[model samples]
Target: MIEKIGFPLVLFAMLAIVLVETNIMTSGIIITIGLNLALALVLTQILALLYGFSKSLKILNKTRRHPLYSPAREASVNAQLRSLKK
Candidate 1:
């Protein structure tokens, strides 16, 4: 499935900072929260990228021995391997 909310926390924290900066928000606590939040979200994205890369590497390693990935070899015949008719 696709990730519609990829890095949502990071985006929300950034927007919150923008909202707080224009005096539209009166809460002083949000400034500290937003700054820390932005840093945290940045780290989260980095970790997500690392995890995805690692997973892909593992999958590629596991699939390396599959028939489609085997070293090229001449077949006994080049005819169709099977009929596709219904």
Candidate 2:
């Protein structure tokens, strides 16, 4: 997660520096844009994390509702027990 946001933030900072050096934008404007971009990136990361968490919860619920022991499994176990007794 850190790598996902950190790399892009580093690139944005470098770009802001270059833009400022080239006189393409003022410091205040660059700062504002950089902050907004960072906010957007962080929000996107949070949304992605939430989406993944929801998916995991859904899978967990499905597994919990599924029966671990069915009739066939019970029969198999009983057969093994009988064979052992014999």
Candidate 3:
């Protein structure tokens, strides 16, 4: 949820900053600083989301590389081994 909204939030914040600078919207120093801070926060959230995705991908690749990690193949192999033992 946060990841999806982060980008739009950043864009909106940037637009607000532009509006403030252009005097199209009446605002004060505090509002400008607040908008800048909000922009930084949204950007940080985006970075965190990217880092989390990378970590998940790494974990998925590691699991895929394991010899017995495939569910269908492991089930068939298990059945064959049981039949041989019997």
Candidate 4:
């Protein structure tokens, strides 16, 4: 599902709104907490994607050292390596 709203932001907004409606917190407090929670939630997703991409790049770099990395370098190259199967 496409999340139009992040869970954290929704949760915070709900709680803040409820508190204000109940006279537990003021509207000013809701504005403060809601904005910060939204920012933090978005940053979390951004950082997760950044780290995941880094890990993928590292795996590709490591695999490039393997002989099978490029199976069809050239016709002669494959002939030189010989078939792994007997």
Candidate 5:
């Protein structure tokens, strides 16, 4: 939920800053157009990269492992196994 809204908000803020900077510098039409295109390409690539990273993060958050449990949990489970062996 947070990621859905936050990413675009941040992108727009950054693009606004770049536009303001370019306008302040009085960039010519060709230069401004080129800059905008480059910015678009870079932002698209960044968004794609961020999406992949977030998806992997979501997957990682959902996974569970007994080895990752606390030492106390591991010890209890090990003791149970040893008793069963006997």
Candidate 6:
């Protein structure tokens, strides 16, 4: 997914830079846009991690028959158990 998303992001950034060079954008606007996008990506990643952690915690508190019981969730719970054991 990162590979899929990264190509399009790079393409868009390059396109924006090209537009700026063509006088279609004002000075500092391109850089500001790029910085904002970068910050958004960073925050998105943080938010995803937080969501994953919350989901994992929820799974830990539920029984096996819970609809949200996924293999990945189980794996995360097991990893947490092992870490706690150490």
lDDT, candidate 5, 31-79, per-residue tens:
5564675677689889999999999987756543435657677579889
Number of colliding residue pairs in model 5: 0
Model 2 C-alpha RMSD vs. true structure (Å) is 11.4
Off by over 4 Å in 3: 1-25, 73-86
TM-scores for all candidates: the values are 0.52, 0.47, 0.49, 0.49, 0.36, 0.47
Better of 3 and 6 by lDDT: 3
What C-alpha RMSD separates each model from the true structure? 7.8, 11.4, 10.1, 10.5, 13.1, 8.4
Which model scores highest in lDDT? 3
Using TM-score as the yardstick, the better of models 5 and 6 is 6
Which ten contiguous residues of candidate 4 have the minimum total lDDT? 1-10
Better of 3 and 6 by TM-score: 3
Clashes of each: 0, 0, 0, 0, 0, 0
Clash pairs, model 3 backbone: none
Report the lDDT tens digits of candidate 4 across residue range 30-72. 6678756666667988999999999999987887777777746
Better of 2 and 6 by lDDT: 2
Better of 2 and 4 by TM-score: 4
| Model 3 lowest lDDT segment of ten | 25-34
Q: Which stretches of candidate 4 lie over 4 Å from their true place?
A: 1-9, 13-27, 67-86
Q: What TM-score does prediction 1 earn? A: 0.52
- The sequence of per-residue lDDT tens digits that candidate 3 reaches over residues 1-74 is 98998788767777777777788875877567658867788788899999999999999799879986887986
Task: Tell me the tens digit of each residue's lDDT in model 6 across 15-72.
Answer: 7667666877746776668646766777988999999999998876776667867889
Q: Looking at candidate 1, what is the lDDT of residue 84?
A: 30
Error of 4 at 9 (Å): 4.9
Question: 15-69, model 2: which lDDT tens digit per residue?
Answer: 7767766878766977678756767877988999999999999996886567783
lDDT of 1 by residue, 11-40 (tens): 768877887777787476766777788888
Looking at model 4, residue 32 earns an lDDT score of 72
